[model samples]
Target: MRIRTAGVVAVLGLALAASGCGDNSKDEPAAKDSPKAASGKLVIWADDKRAAALKPFGEKFGQENGVTVEVQAVSKDLQTNFVTASQQGSGPDVVVGAHDWIGNLVQNGAIDPVQLAAEQKSAFNETAVKAVTFNGQVYGVPYATENIALIRNTELAPEAPKTIEDLVASGKKLKAEKKASEILCLQSGQNGDAYHIYPLYTSAGGYLFGTAANGDYDPKDLGVGKPESIAAFQKIAKLGEKGDGALKRSITGENSIATFTGKKCAYLVSGPWAIADAKKAGIKYDISPVPGFAGGKEAQPFVGVQSFYVAAKGKNKALAQEFVTNYVTKPDLAVALYNAEPRPPALTAAFDQVKGTDPDLAKFSEAGKNGQVLPAIPAMAAIWDPFGKAEAAVIGGADPTKTVTAAGKTISGQIK
Candidate 1:
């Protein structure tokens, strides 16, 4: 499988979403292709955003090591592409992708664990390091971290919603005044969207999996079918169209941002990715935690980290390790990647440097301050479609108990 450029990445991006918890680990049978190895050289694959900034460092590494270093752009479906290529013994020495890719990558034997010193690990945000660490080893060197947060229109609701109820109440009043067409742009589509709804789910006491004693996700501890999940979705159902009409199926993933940008909604539960559109639409917005249910637990969004992994089957394994462990771990590279992508830098020094220049990054970092590290275990893949459909069904007025209960069964079957 050949890797494509940034302009055509949707398919690769959907690979993981199609398969499980992310775009990086999308489900596909492994395909073996010939290795594209260049003699006496080191190759690194990454998205376009980081390639340019990484070039100089790659060259510097080559100069010091007396080897040619190629920084290739594998802008599309990087994680899946890397995996498939690895199967054929034909992937780059290093691959840059989301931290969540660890589970599937490790399962496919595509990436080698990156060994970082204690201080080296401490140099990064703990969450980034944790996301890259699966089981007992770290497989990637993280550069940045990101998560969703509430983006509210300042003019429509000056103060941040203290709770999810406050957000809904304010929206309903605005709806009554004909000032807004929707209550909120949370976007539960026809089939449901677990990602967008996770804050509310967790706030109402839902969890996907519990951590092992070692602090890694324990696949055996499934949370979807448990009573806590049922209780959580029951609360989620109340906000659906069948009950308070706060969460409408009409507010789909495609339209939520548009709806918010058009001023049809006072609040939008989204990530930093949505900020550009808000700025373009000239909406007066402020970032905050996705408010929880009134008097309930604090809302928690899933935290994601973007990092560099050394491909286990690369042509040059030792060089791959050197590149990831020594070259990619720098604070400047972290800052450079952040400039290209604008997520929170994982390295403390980079984060400190950027936070002074970009307050929005700081705001978002705080928004996900207490957020849960999104589970990267293979079991996590099973929860997406089943849970999404169930949530959508509940939002559309189906019995939350029956719908969520059935969805839990589906997930259990897959994981089993």
Candidate 2:
């Protein structure tokens, strides 16, 4: 992916809904194309918005297949509930959720590998496909991709900063001029947010896990507690409360976008989901890559893919496979989903059509060119809380080296 030289003129809005928890351990079973009658009922579960968007498509598909299609809206705990219901042999044939849930879904035998032809697989964003793949098998059909970018108010800071140092300098100037109340709106709450802070962490040379030869994260090769991670934390300390005072526990995920939309800050490190509020606030803004450290590596955010999975133990496996493998791959369906939620389409064809109207999709895609796919390995569950708390402590003035080292140990223990 290349970062194109594009100016953000008309901004588009997006909202990334709830991402739930799941993990994978054993190899997922392959989806077999069983020859069966298509007249049976096909039930699908999704969050409210997606359910609403899919109803029309589902009805059309049902009519074409001579079947009944029910798109149920599970407002809360969709992933956990799907898992529980699948285990009891009572879940829907299809479930829409984040790709990160592939691990646990596979581990619990709640979802099956989604069979896609080579051309179909290649039709979507490469990173989106990679996110839904587990143990070398594609497990879901991805619809949208999301990652954080540097969203700056053009009215407050006309030019995009090249690096973290440059951003800090510009923000400091804005604050000193009494034009802005805060320097940056990157969130680091009391418990920390590893997801939102990942760009900065990587820019400072910190890594979560080492990758294997297959390009999969190696759970055994934890990068925390290492010399490089210690060095990275030390660098981050300079931006903490004890240093530049830019990162604050008060700036949370719930409020970071508001801070920027409210014009209290010049810059916000956020994803496409925040764009809706930003557009509503009527701020003249532009999107760019989250700048890296002065001499460090490029800042890489976590790329999250939203996907649809086939329940492993659903009553209508044949119908489910037909819907997920064939019906869901259509560019029109992808375009419709985008219209419902306005995320960057994972399908290349759909994205191509949408980019002409929603140029912010192109800008966001450029911003996340160097992004790392959010890991879906079961071991990843162990890294969140411990790592987040350690990050919070360091941001609140704890010893960077000691605190990070302890976090690494805690994560290691949990993984073990």
Candidate 3:
């Protein structure tokens, strides 16, 4: 993938930060214990991308405050590692994670509620904050947000389809001319991806969880097998059957991007991460909201937010709060982060800065304007497995309604 100029600048900033930063690992003497220092050390665990980006900031913060900052890039399982490390009193002072993981993190007592200043609160996306809120308490600071939208290869279809019928018709045209493999490309592995497929379900007016008085997801009101979900699945099943079941278990994020960029498919439902590759392949594309099904509502994908959370068990809570609230939340930092990664910014001002620069991001923001935040309730852990199986059943030729209904019952029972 060809890296954009903005992306290059972001990477350079991160590289500079990583090299200039001081070691703040536990192995080092506590800065406070050193007579010349002002405070203590702060440890942070982040994914590789974030870790690289934050290294320079860490070095700067450490130097400015006389407190050392340690950054470790843990690639595999953040949640599992956080839980295990916290129990051993060796976890990070702060963690970078997703909002949906709030439920489990809170339940496990692995994170603490963050108390943002009123001004700080105003600077963030309310919906992003709400995603990390559980039982009336806020737990994380969101840095970025994401959602899927319809991305069409302009070479194959110059204009984006406004409805499922339009998408299907375009697909049929491509197939007739042997220009495409299928009308719509979706992932349907044994464990189906309900998150990515959510737009299709919502387009049919189905929802996985109902809302409460406060708009929090009501776990008891499971809607997996709702008539709308079934209808939506049936529509996709019909397309799968007619197209030789091209939407198979093997189809993944990588493959989906390939299909569109390779010009083998006209429309792909994806997020901003695919932009670099799409551009590099020299394929012209435009994004739009996922179209609604017949007699159904507009397709609304689940909105996801990437956030930072203070560790309740951290030894340096005050310093961690200072870093997140004072430094990371600034417009300059926010803009740098967004430009580096190109997801929707949680801060409105920062978001507005680059909103016009990236068309893909703008389309995603539009698509998510009416989208529901993915349920962060702990019960969501039980929904993914069974619901995915039901989607697989539909793709495998079983009745959509029956499969989804069974899956819903199983999920509800497990939660109970």
Clashes of each: 4, 5, 1
lDDT (Cα, tens digit) per residue for candidate 2, span 154-246: 999999999999999999999999999999999988899999888889998999999999999999999989888888888888998998978
> Which candidate leads in TM-score?
2
lDDT score for candidate 2 against the true structure: 0.85
Q: Per-residue CA lDDT of candidate 1, range 1-416, in tens?
A: 44533221111111111111111222321111212224546778887768876877776656555566778887678777888889988788888888778898999889888756665777889889889988878888899899999999999989998988888899999999998988899877888888889989999999999888888888888889899999998998889887778898888889999999999999999888898899999998999888999878989999999988888888887667666776677777787787777899999999998898887898899989999998888888898899999998888888878888898889989999
Best by lDDT: 2
Residue pairs clashing, model 2: 22-104, 23-103, 23-104, 24-103, 24-104
Evaluation by TM-score, superior candidate among 1 and 3: 1
lDDT of 3: 0.76
Kindly give the stretch of ten consecutive residues in candidate 2 with the minimal lDDT sum: 1-10
Between candidates 1 and 3, name the one with more favorable lDDT: 1
Query: CA lDDT of each candidate?
Result: 0.81, 0.85, 0.76
- Residues 264-378 of candidate 3 have per-residue lDDT tens digits of 7888878888888889999888888888776778788889999888888888876776666556676777776786688899988888888777766777888788888988999
What shift in Å separates residue 330 of candidate 1 from its native position after superposition?
Answer: 1.1
